[model samples]
Target chain A: MEIRIGHLYPDLLNLYGDRGNIQCMVKRCQWRGIEASVTEYQLEDPIDFSGLDIILLGGGSDREQAIVCEKLKTIREDFKAYVEDMGVVLAVCGGYQLLGHYYDTDQGRIEGLSLADLYTEQGSPRLISNIIIENEDFEMPFVGFENHGGRTYTGDLKPLGKVLFGCGNNGKDKKEGILYRNIVGTYLHGPLLPKNPHLCDYLLKNALMRKYGQAELSPLEDREEKEANLYIRKRFLERQ
Target chain B: MKVRRLMAVWTAKIISAACRLSGRQGVTLAGKIALKIDPGILRDLSSQVREKIFVVCGTNGKTTTNNLLCSAVESEGKKVICNHTGSNMLSGVAAAFVLSAGISGRLDADYACIEIDEASTLRIFPHFKPDYMILTNLFRDQLDRYGEIDLTMKILSQAMAMAPEMKLILNGDDALSAYLAMESKNDFVTYGITEQVFHDQDSREIREGRFCKKCGAKLEYEFYHYSQLGRYRCPSCGFERPPIEYDAKNISMEHGLSFEVEGRSFHADYRGFYNIYNILAAYAGAREAGFALSRFSQVLESFNPQNGRMEQFSIDGTKIILNLAKNPAGFNQNISAVMEDPSEKDLIIVINDNAQDGTDISWLWDVDFERFLDPSVKSVTVSGIRCQDMRLRMKYVDIPSTLVEDVEKAIKDRIQHGCGNLYVLVNYTALYSTRNILAGMQER
Candidate 1:
């Protein structure tokens, strides 16, 4: 099955190796003899949300994030429709904050897409560190890095996981990321998917299941991924 | 005040000596301690400089450019105070001054060539204003420490405003650096390679300066040398590369590097193509400071920055090259330098997630490790704290890698059993430790 991945503002919203998520997804699909293609939708490019199996919105610098927030606002209805259709979407860091209600920064309040009932406020001393999360949906824990000044609150959405290590979403709340339908939005950006093969596969499975009604993906050699994931989990999680 | 300055210098000197006696580099620790003793130590010491002070700032090549500028000034029979170690922070800058000062806290140097960390420029500027600020190039480096490139530019712009009299020596090809020069309105001289040298497709993937800093428009590049450092212009607002005063023409990187800048032929036995900018930066800085360039080539010929920057080592008739590859841009350039060698080579990449190394190891994916799948690459070994992440990065590219937990052991294994030609690429925290390991093994 062919999976068309739509990368929103790949040029603007790329920071902290965010493209690695796209690479991880593409590589995983190719390894399983599945055709995967990535169509990068720039700021001016028209995005056909219906043709996409998976959509990735990565993080960017503050200036780039503001520019992308404006572009994302124009396509809010289309994106909301895509999410309602159960299309797989992975938004990270700044992108995750932009998908919410609004991000209150020192400069002023920047409006978000309001796809989810989430909002973020700028916090002092950025919550930056290696983050591990425990999700009941997966057998293994998710491992990634988190660096953000905005502390997000998942208003009514279910959290992706519990914070096993490091600050997640808001340090006050133990909730890490917002998980609504097939959408996964988080602050963990060690591009968040390469080491966490289970999550990568989960997103791929959701995308494939939506397109062809079945996702019997053959298991690929995940020795490296498993080792990398376990290394972080064992390092941070086992200590706690 | 004199007693306090004297105490700070002597205490720092004693601490530095004690650190050496205890077999520790103590590169920045003494500076940290000295600053604690006297907060005004940097200002007091730097104020005593007999001549001009040059400050080098940028993401990469700061240390090398600063050291080279020091050597270039020293070649003209002038005493130069420089932070030889790659310590570019405020404490390091203080240490450079404190350590260089005599026991009486008196600096007798003619020129002070200090490499100030871009993030620490504002802190460093309050102490002493540099006569010339040499910005080698601006690429995304250690995002955790420096925030974003915009933040860094903002910091630098504020720092430059503090010292309006300071001239700028910038890499013209870097649109980010060039734009900063244009915005600052400083008397700046740019040096850039007008020709396209690097054809690596991977280098083009990780450019941080794709958008125009002025108009927020997509930058139009005529050709990219590597990673946004090329002839670029913006369609909107008419922002473009400044006219290069020191244009490096007829560049050749076959045997080291050979290039001509302003009708003067210069060559260095440097490995990476990026060294041309470093050398050019130093040349432009030295010239701008009114230093004689008669012994410039001689300085370049003799300058071998042995602190893990293309530092060479020999063990048991095997040639080993150690270099620091901290960020994606640096690692990509490091990979290109490695690929330049056609000989069969064993590669050991040590990736640490230390606070200094930008705890986020995600930048590894931005580096094109798939290029390591060449026929000449015999074995690839991953080491350090984030070795598993490095191994996983390699695995996605279908390149099999061996994970060695210990960096020294990884180096030892490759030097003993693998091919005689070895290349060790390391990030910030791993550089010194791995260099020490390589040094110890070489002595054995």
Candidate 2:
């Protein structure tokens, strides 16, 4: 079976190499013998979340974000359905800001899917920086950059990872990423997957297992990926 | 070095304060401040920048192109860093990256894309060691600061020297951008308009940049797209818009001109044929950045240029199209777009005599305000601090101007009863204040 990915607002919510996250995912999944297809949804278009295994969102300025915010209003109900049903979703920086309950600024307020246990206040003084994230349960690295004035105050939710490098998800706060069942959220940026290839393999495996029902999917450890995991894990350990 | 830098800081402060009193746009002030604080401050900040750097530079479409490239990368699910604020310089860039780095000084991401100004490019490139440089477009802007085309070209040459390894993503129509293709070591890519917008003519209105550098010969253009950008080849030097890596095909300049790249057409919600090329450059630059066309196309199709650029706002039954026009080339293109609306819109052209607007206001003479004589344009209202200068320039074009004063009043009087759309053209210094005036008018 093939893993289908939904790229939400590819046109409106993209400002950086946000799509690189998808490419990294597609390559990792395909290398592990999983088929993946990404469907992009634009403004005012129908939100068909059918057969979707993953979704990706990215960052932009307040003005750019505002445009997408207008479009997102109409689809809040659709996004809420995905979150409640335990759909696998990934959002970074502005995308992460957008997925939360609210993204507020001086002008007005823009609402998100209210999926994860996160809330953001735009124009706040809690500007976050580059992060090195890890969770105690999973001895792996979660890397990405954060440059936002929006302060994210996490509520009761499972932490995605702890800080291994520069800053954790948010500054001083041990909260970096949010991991809930099949949903993962963080401010980690481009090249995040490249630095954390182990996460890529694991996410791909998760998608593949659901697609093939654990019957036809390849084994978790290939010679190449096993070497890569070892190397990446050592790099994370060195950071510690 | 520190002592001299301290003195330069003082000099920059004095110069900045003097400029503010004189009502100058703060480009020169901030640039001077940067120059004073550290002669090589840009170099210092740039050294700290982790490689895999990307620099977006152009005249009309730099901001849009930079934003588009950033959008494509972000869609790839990467943490991408760029100047969210319009402060696109050494200091602004410093403020952005410094805030993103760790105490150990490691950047958060594997990539950094920056939009650099034309004038500051030379001093700043040594700092931004770009893996890829998207040279978006080159048009005549702030002739006073840039002097003439040749001076700007010289500065670009100096900037290019620092990043010899940078793959140049160029505008094929632009003489300045295409010139960098001569460096064989640097992998260069070009994007330009393929669809014909205007009838090709040798009219005096065409300010082509086709002067032969070899023998002072008036270079012949196969056509003219806006200024001197067209299919040009110096007969002496054999300089031409190279075979494009990603050429825009079937370009149409109607209703926010859209174009196709590599057989895929993308629509931008804004007008002007120039923007099509901007999107094209973004696509080429992003693709070279290892992003799939599918991902890049997805981001650009829904993108819009903000910051009072081709942005529309309504206040009490008046449709106002606010666009930023700083130099002669930009002002001229904006005029052409506004004139094409066919709805007989009211016109308000704001001019600034500020330093950021360029000390040499003489570039006004270069603008083809003669286009204003068309029937679609009902009335011309001139404002900004340099209103009289624009009035003088309009008089040369025989433009009758009974109403000329503050920007708000001009818009209010012209756009009062049954006016469809009021197009406001403000220079750099006047744009922010003009926008503020519009916001204030809405309050009333």
Candidate 3:
């Protein structure tokens, strides 16, 4: 089966090796004998959400974010429609911030796509550290790096996980990321997949299910991925 | 002023001596003590110096470029005071001035070449008016500490506003670096590669400065030498790469680097365009300090970068090329430098997340490790605090992983079984610790 991944604002919103996530998804599917293609959608590119099985949005700098935010406002209707159709979307960091209602900043509030019932406020001293989180869907704690200045309130939506280590979503709450319908928005990006194979598989399964109506993915012996996850989990847990 | 200078000197000396007795390097400690004793020590001591002061800075290559400029100036038979230690902070700059001064706090030198950090520039430039300020290039580094790339530009621009009369030497190829000269009324000279030197297909892998500073339009590159640094022009606005005053023309990376600047051919042991920019910046900077190009070129022949910045060693008959990469630009350049060799070689990438190394490890994803999947690579070994993350990043590239618990053992394992050259790429803290471990092995 062919899986199409639309990488949103690859030129603008790729701050923290954001391309690594797209590459990780592509490679995992390729290893499983499935054809996966990535279509980079930059500014003004037609957002044909129907063709895309998964939409990956990475993070970028404030200047790039401002540019992408302006472009995003123009495609809010199309993006909302795509989300309504249960498209598997994974947005990270700055991308995660843009999926909310508005990103409040010192300069003013920047309008977001509002696909998820969330909002972010720019705060002093950014939250940056190695983070571990636990979700109902995964047995192991999801390990990744989180660096964001915007304090996001998930508001009623099911959170992707609880903050097991480091600050997530907001320092006040233990919750991290948002999992609304098929959309997954988080500040984590160890490319958010290579280390956390379970999460990668979860997204892949969602995408596969959306396309073929079934996703009985044969586990590709995640020996290395498992070892990597175990090592990180132990390191952070030991530090505590 | 003399008495305060003497007080600062004596206090720093005692602290430095105590640190030495305890078997610790007192370079940073001495500076800290000197600054504590007299907050105005750097300013007071620098003001008394009859010699010209040159402040070299950027995200990367500050050490090598600073050292190269110092060596070139020294070759002209002048006493030069430099912070040879890797401490480029405000305290480190103060320590260099305090320690170099006589007992009376009177500096006896013809030149003082100090490397300043980009963030520290705002603090240092306000008090110390440099005769020449050389900015190598700017890249997004240590987001936790330095914030964003634009923030760095803001800091450096504010710092430049203070040094209105200082001759600014900048890398014309870098948009952010060249942008410094935009508002500065100071006399400036630009150094850049006139043409593309490498044929690497993955040239524009990670562009740090893509938008035009003037118009916010996407900048067009004639060809990326690496990242957004190249001969570029903005289609929306007429902003383009300034005409380079000192151009690195014929660059051939055969064995080592051989390039020409203004018809003067110079050879350097350093490889890659980044190092070439360092050498070119130094050449231009040295000339600004009134040193002849011939003398600077002569000194560069014997100048080797210090403390594991492209330092090489041999262990058990295995050739090891070790270097430090604090950010993506440096790391990417080192990767490309290793890829220049088609012969099969074992690779070791060591990463650390120490506070000094910037606790954020997300930048590792920005490095194009997929290029390491070349058939010439025999093995890939990962080590350091974030080795698993490195391994995972490389896994996507389809390269098999060898996670050695100890960095020393990892290098040894590669040397023990490897048949060809071993390229060890380390970041920040790993660079020094791994080098110290392997340096001992090299001696035996």
Best by lDDT: 1
Listed in order, each prediction's TM-score against the native is 0.97, 0.57, 0.96
Candidate 3 steric clashes = 1
Stretches of model 3 off by over 4 angstroms after superposition? B1-7, B14-24, B199-204
| Model 1 alpha-carbon drift over 4 Å, by segment | B199-204
Residue-by-residue lDDT tens digits, candidate 2, A1-240: 577888876654543445556655776567666677878775646877756777787765565566777778787787778766666777777788887788778768877667766787755444434455666666555654455667676777777777666554456677776777667777766334544556666666566555455634454443332333344345445766
**DockQ list for all candidates:** 0.83, 0.01, 0.69
Winner on TM-score (1 vs 3): 1
How do the residues B313-333 of candidate 3 rate in per-residue lDDT, one tens digit apiece? 999899988989878888888
Candidate that beats the other on lDDT, 1 or 3, i.e. the better one: 1
Contacts from the true interface found in each model, as a fraction, amount to 0.86, 0.00, 0.72
Error of 2 at A192 (Å): 60
DockQ for model 1 equals: 0.83
The alpha-carbon deviation from the true structure for residue B440 of candidate 2, after best TM-score superposition, in angstroms, is 5.2
Judging by TM-score against the true structure, name the best candidate: 1
Ten contiguous residues minimizing lDDT sum, candidate 1 chain B: B196-205
